[model samples]
Target chain A: MNKRELAKRVAEKCGQSQVVSTLVINTFISCILESLEAGEKITIQDFGTLSVKQQKKRERFNLATNKVETYLPYDYIKFTASKSVKIKQKEKSVKKE
Target chain B: MNKRELAKRVAEKCGQSQVVSTLVINTFISCILESLEAGEKITIQDFGTLSVKQQKKRERFNLATNKVETYLPYDYIKFTASKSVKIKQKEKSVKKE
Candidate 1:
């Protein structure tokens, strides 16, 4: 589902208006982005953990040009779903087959 | 940061009470988890995309036991950060070096 639909559902679940729900949702997203940008890890109960992982600078060969290039290191967000969620996923797969 | 801290920040940003903010945050997480469990993808603008990925059933060797084992297929949540977030990460790395 998209953001709008998700917001609607959240609003209903929280007994709030759509506009307020949207604002809350937006704030939630910004909070996560800000935390990651600041190199902080975020852990939501029953959801998972989100953190930034840095990759080291590396050299790679260009097959076509036969040249070596250096790629700068960068960071990326890593998310690990909660064990309950993982178990639920496994159960769903088992049911499907 | 943990869920309580996140909710506090969100509450302050959205000018809502801590109780309501916590409720909204909980609902938001539940929404994503439910969507993934239902095999739906959730995309939040400027944040990232969350989807469930299914792994095919396969065979693996148990090194200690030295026996072949059949592993059942399972599903996992995959999150891809937004382009802006990626660019920001690269810039942060550049500054550090």
Candidate 2:
């Protein structure tokens, strides 16, 4: 599913127009990005937490090139799903199995 | 930050009422949860992808009791940030350094 499909579903469920849903989605994304860029975390109930973790600069060997290179440290996003989500997902998968 | 803070920022930026913004945010989260429950991946542009990964059941030894236990399989959510987000985060960290 992409943004358009998600927006459609949200609009239907929220009884709102797709245009407004799309705008809200955009705003939501923008807010997350801004917060992460500012080194902050966003915690949404029953969803997950979005945060950035800074990795240390390290040397890694390139398998294809057979050379060692120093990679600069960068921040990466980490998301941990809520316990309720985890339980639900596990239940579904177990039923499928 | 929490959901309320996020909704406040989004409402301010989108010039929408807090009630509407909160609704949108809730809908956004619900949409994601529903998609994941249905085993679908959501890809938001310039944000990241949300998907579920199932792990196989395995046996592990308990550290404290030293007893072997079988752990049930579970599904987990994974998120990977966009290249633009990575670059921006790196730049900010470099400036701080």
Residue-wise C-alpha lDDT for candidate 1, range B6-71, written one tens digit per residue: 999999999999998888889988888888877788988778899988778899999999999988
Off by over 4 Å in 1: A87-92, A95-97, B87-92, B95-97
User: By DockQ thresholds, what CAPRI class is model 1?
Assistant: medium
In angstroms, the error of model 1 at A31 is 1.4
The TM-score, computed over Cα atoms with residue i paired to residue i, of candidate 1 is 0.87
lDDT, candidate 2, B1-97, per-residue tens: 9999999999999888899989988988988888888888899988999888877889999999999998877778989887766535634576334
**Residue-level error in angstroms, candidate 2, position A74:** 1.5
- Backbone clash tally (model 1): 0
The digit string of per-residue lDDT tens for model 2 on A1-97 reads: 9999999999999988999889988998988888888878889888889888878888999999999998877778999987766535634565434
Q: Please write out the lDDT profile of model 1 over residues A32-76, one tens digit for every residue.
A: 888877778899878899998888889999998899998887778
Candidate 1: global Cα-lDDT?
Answer: 0.84
lDDT of 2 at B87: 32
lDDT values of the candidates?
0.84, 0.84
